[model samples]
Structure formats: C-alpha cells, structure tokens
Target: MARKKHTEMSFLDHLEELRWLLIRSTIAIIIVAGACYFIDDYIFNTIIFGPKDPNFITYRFFCGVTHFFGVDDTYACATEFKFIIQNTEVGGQFSIYLWMLVTAGFILGFPYILWEFWRFISPALYEKERKKAALFIIVSSILFFIGVLFGYFVVVPLSINFFATFQASSDIVNQFTIDSYISMIKTSLIASGLVFEMPIIIYFLTKLGLVTPVFLRKYRRAAIVIILILAAIVTPPDIPSQIIVSIPMLILYEASIIISALVVKKQEQNG
Candidate 1:
C-alpha cells in the first residue's frame, strides 16, 4: 500500500521512536498500577465485589424490567447471592493482587497506549488524517472505558451469580477461589475493551480494502449468529444476557459499516 509521508524519520529511526513510545506507555501503566496496589480496598471492595452484591445496577435494572412486564419470577430481584470465594492455595491471594494490578494498570493507561499507537501510524497518514487521529484516541479510550464499565456492571455480575447458584447435585458447594474470581472479572473487562474497538478496526480494514459495505450487508445474518455465540461465551449462557450483550455489539457493527463506507469513499475520491 502507498503511504503518505510526514517527511521525517528513517525506518530504523521510526523503530527507535517506537521503542520510546513503548517505554513511556509501560512507565505510565506501572505508575498507575502502583497506585492500584495501594488502594486495594477500593479496588477489591467497591469495584471488584460491587458485582457480587445483589444491588448491582444490572440486577436492579433487569428486576425493574421484569416487574414492569408483570413477570414476578425475576430472580435478579433477590438481595443475596449464595456463594463463597475461597483461596485453597497460599499463593492464590498474591496472584490475584498481581493480576488485578496489571489489569488495573492497562485500563488506566489505555489512552497513553492508544497515543503511542497513533504516533507509530500517524507518520504514514496524510497530514489531515494525522490531525484527525486525536479524535481517534479520544473516541477509542471512551469506548474502552464504557465497555469496561458494562462488563463490570452487567456481564460479570450475571456470570458470577449464575455460576454460584447453579446446582445439579446437592453434594456440590459453590466455593470459588480468589484467583478464579479475579480471572473471571479480568477476562470480562479486557475482552470487552478489546471487542469495543469495532469501528476503529473496521476503519483500518476499510483502508486496506479488507472489508466493504456490500460484504458486511451480505454477511449480516452470519454476523448476528457469530455475535450471539461470542456473547454466550463471554457472559452467562442465558438468552437475555446474551441478547443484551449482543445488542451493543450489533450497534457497533452497524457503526463500523458506516465508518467503513466513509473510508472507502475517501479512498475513491483520492484515487
């Protein structure tokens, strides 16, 4: 592909610049993570355990929906979940702290990371395109944070509650290890943030001619099925939960379609 030139920096020089970009990004994450380790109380009790509590915003919202529909069997309305998280290994707590801080750092440093990514790509874009990348970073960062919030508030709570309550035999008790719980939440947050980059992904794909409006339109049904399956994998296997998760993704898919169309049009104009 032909690339626009910013009129500076050789290939090796660019790599050197990239190395510094990475160094800065890493430094930012470590600084934020250090703060996270200190504020373990807020991170653990308020943010991490917030979903474990029945008063989570998702449960309350769904409970209200069920009440409005006059279907009174809304289990989400319950004020308590019957489950215990236990650490069977001595190192489990330490592992959870380590991973939790790492994930926290990633979330906190997302914007800086995006900025570094932009710095790498911007030189290859037109001056106008480079200027627009400021909006890209801002939008990408906001979408990621929104996805993190959604995962924490909706997906994590539902999955934990469902798994804890699931009982095929009376002989089994629901005792999740601290590491296991942290892993679940961490996966949810990271996966959600990555998935929410739909429009940006599509923009690049469009630029490379890898995706187009017609292709997306033709595969619309297949995309929906794939999205539902992905939703099921990420959230509890319940239909409502999957649908709720898939809705935002579908909206983002549509947004990606629009973004792809715009990029394609711009390319055609330049050509």
Candidate 2:
C-alpha cells in the first residue's frame, strides 16, 4: 500500500503508522533476544564478565603501555581485584540475565530499528531526503557500534578498575551488587552509543533550521565544558580516562559543525 501524502494523512493515521513502527521494532528486538538465549553462557561468562578478569584484553593493553613507559607498581599490573560481585536478591541474577538479553538484542538489532524509524519519518521528508535512508542507517549504526566498543573497552574497564582498587580505608571491604555492576555497564555502552550520533542529530537540526555552523562555532567553548562533564560522569575520576573519552566527542562536535555547514549551503543552493 502506498503511503498517503503528509497533508492527506489524518492525525489518527499518523498515530496508526507510529503504532506499527513500534510493534515491528519490538518484535525485531524480541527475536534477536531469543536467539541470544542459546549463547547465554558465552554472553555471561565471556562478554559480560570478561572485564573483571585481570587478563582482559583492554587491561592487558593498558598494562603493556604502562610497562613500555617504565611505570612501576601501577594498578594496571595488579593480578586480582579486591572486590567480589554479590547477588543479594534471590532473583537478582535471573533479573540481570533478562535485562542483558534485552540490551544485547537492542544493540544487535539497532540497524533494523533504524530502518523502522526511518520508515516512520520518511513520509514527511522530501523524496530526495528519503532516498538517503540507507546511508543514514549505515552511518548511524557504524557510529553507534564504535561508541559501544569504546564504552566497553575504555570506559567500563577504567571504571571497574578504579572502583575495584579504590578504598577509603583498609577496614572497608568492597562488595558490588550484580545489579549495580550491570547498570554501570549498560549505562556506559548506551550513553556512548547515543553520544556518537551527534553528527546525525546536527544534520537533521540543520535541515529544520534549528542549528547552524555559526551557532555551533559560537558555542564551541560551552560544548567542550559539557563534553568534559559528561566524560567525567561516564569515566573514572581520573584525568587520563576523561581525556580518552573527551577526544572522540570533541571530534564529533567539530564534525557536526561541518555537517551543519554543508546542510545550510545545500539549502541556500536550493533557494
């Protein structure tokens, strides 16, 4: 069935379309999550718990870097964490397992989710703009996955390492709940992925005349402060870790300015 023109579609018609979009996206997620059940062991033991291991690749890489730089007695060289993860609630682990399945499903099913979203909005876009759906989905998904990897490899490890080692006193032992651990991991991955969509976001804002290159430039200093604050919130309270997170976001902000400029230039040409 052909979609009605935006002007022809009634408000209920738009709502009906949105309803189907959500339904389809949810089904996609559920299917992907169901497939994940078969590999639950690998998901839990290898991927989810991997960061806690001293020999995790991220830790090993950092350790190697510190070793090459002749750093002595750094936490990077530690063989074990002082904390143990505990599940106080009887159903805590089960609850975490279900939540992780949904998270993994959403991550893996992101492209399809984007497709569904595009389908919802494309009816309102010009034909030329609608034609760019594939490009938009591809680029957005790539950026999102890269951010997720960065969060996993950089943010999560640094956070876990810092919390594991940090102590106010020798008498206070550190014990983390499974729920808290999973929450940190989920927040880091999802937040980073969303942050990486700044360019895509700016492009649309530009198209809508809500943002401009000059505006982005004028606020660059403020954006930097906000980015640093976000980095500090997600990463460990250390300068190096914050720097590591900030660099990519700073780059993305610059890219957003460029994108906004191009969009405005195109609009001017059309006019």
Candidate 3:
C-alpha cells in the first residue's frame, strides 16, 4: 500500500489532528500542574518569594559584584528593604497559586509541548527536514530555559530591588500587592522566554523568505534601540540594569542574523 501524502489530507483531517494535539498538550500540562499543586509550600515560599529576600542567590551575587567593585551606597549591597507583599483581595492568593501551578506546568512540560507542536508541522516539511524534530525541540527548550533563568536571576532581582527600595518620600512605604508581584515574575519569565526564541523565529522566517540577513543588518540599529526600550521596560529605570538586560538581547539578535544567513545559504545550496 502506498503511504498517503501530507497534502492528501483534507481540511477536516487537519482540524481533527489539531484537536487531538490540543487535547494531548492540555492533558500534559494539567497532569504536570496537578503534581505542582501538591508542592505549594515550595512553590509559594521558596521559588515565588525568593527574589523578595535580600539573601536570595541573585541578590547575594550582585552584592558580591558591587562589593568587589567597591561601589558605595548602592542598592545591591543593601542587606534588606522595607516592604510588605499583601493580598488585598480575598481570592488573590488562591488565584496566584492556581496561576503558579499552571506556569510551572507549562515550564516543565515545554519540551512535550514543543514535540507535539513539531509533530503538527512536520508533515508539511520535506523528509530530511522532518528528521530535525529532536534538534528543534532541544534547541528551543534550551533557549527557553536559559531565558527563564536570566529573567529570574537578573531581571527579577534588579526590578524587585529597585522598586522595593525606591520611594518618593520617607513617609511613603512600598506595599506591593501579591498579584502585582506575581505578575512581575510572570511577565519577566514569559517575555524573556519568548524573546530568546528570536533565532528560531528568524530561521523559519528566512526559510519562508519573509526575512533576510541583509534586511536584519540594515535595521540592526533600530533593533538595538527597540531592545534597549524593552530592557528598560522590563528592568528598573536605571542605565546599568537596562544595559545588562539589553546585552543578552543584542547577542540574541546577532545570533538570529547568523541563523538567518545560514538558512539562506542552505536554501541557495539546495536550489
């Protein structure tokens, strides 16, 4: 019997395949989230609240750097800050917990999700390209996890330290809502994770002829400006923090250019 070609599948068949993919992905997330729910203590107190503490690893690392550089009167070396994270709404904490579980589930099940996503798209690719499913998942997952670590360690600590210590007057206290704090964490992690996928995005765009290395190089300066703006938005309103955040992004952009060039080269060779 002859194997059916991917183009032979009807629109309904595609929809049915998509439905199953969604079902499988959702079930994977739910199962992981269910396990995360049982570890509420660790999730809430340790991971979630860790950056709030002056003794957190990120804070300590920065403090060490500041001390090593002999920087005086900097927030990095400060041992503590005055702030209270309160749940103003009755369901605020509960909502945060649920969201945390879902976030954890997504992070942990990201590889599986990527695999399922690749499965959906692989049918349209050549057999040689289809063989790259494992490479695609591995590289994407590594980039995502690196982004998460960067957000949690660098961006989160910088923002938390800056905001927790900033004040208009001595009389004004920093009382952040629980939801607000969680939102900061979520935004940092998710945004950075997505940002780190720029190279992969560029690869696909290049493959589809939507983007070229020449175009990227031509607009490189504009991209740098935009990246700085994003860094400032995510991090504290300080030059150093923004620079630190922007550096990785600039590196990602450069990497993306290389990836795009390589893709174009491969296409040229094949053609």
In what order do the candidates fall by lDDT, top score first?
2, 3, 1
**Top of the candidates by TM-score:** 2
Candidate number with greatest lDDT: 2
- Sorted on TM-score, best first, the list reads 2, 3, 1
For candidate 2, the 10 contiguous residues with the lowest summed lDDT are 1-10
For model 1, how does the per-residue alpha-carbon lDDT over 1-271 read when each residue is reduced to its tens digit?
Answer: 3556456778899889989998998888988899888898899898988888888788888889888998885476777777888889888788888878878998989998999899888876777778787799999999999888878877898897678767789898778888788889999998998899988888888877899988998899999999999999998878878888899999999999888888888888988
Candidate 1: regions farther than 4 A off: 1-20
* 1-271: candidate 2 lDDT, tens digit per residue: 2434656778999899999999999999999999999999998999889999988998899899998998975787678988999999999989999999999999999999999999888887888788899999999999999999999998999998888988999999999999999999999999999999999999998988899999999999999999999999998898888998999999999999999999999888978
Return the TM-score for candidate 2, rounded to 2 decimals. 0.95
- Cα lDDT for residue 144, model 3? 93
Candidates' RMSD to native: 2.3, 2.4, 2.3
- lDDT scores for all predictions? 0.86, 0.92, 0.90
lDDT of 2 at 39: 96
Give the clashing residue pairs of candidate 3, or none: none
lDDT tens digits, residues 1-271, model 3?
2223756789999999999999999999989999998897998899889998889998888778887888765688668879999999988878888889999898889899999999998877778888889999999999999999899899999999999889889999889999899999999988898899899999988988999999999999999999998998999999989999999999999999999999999889978
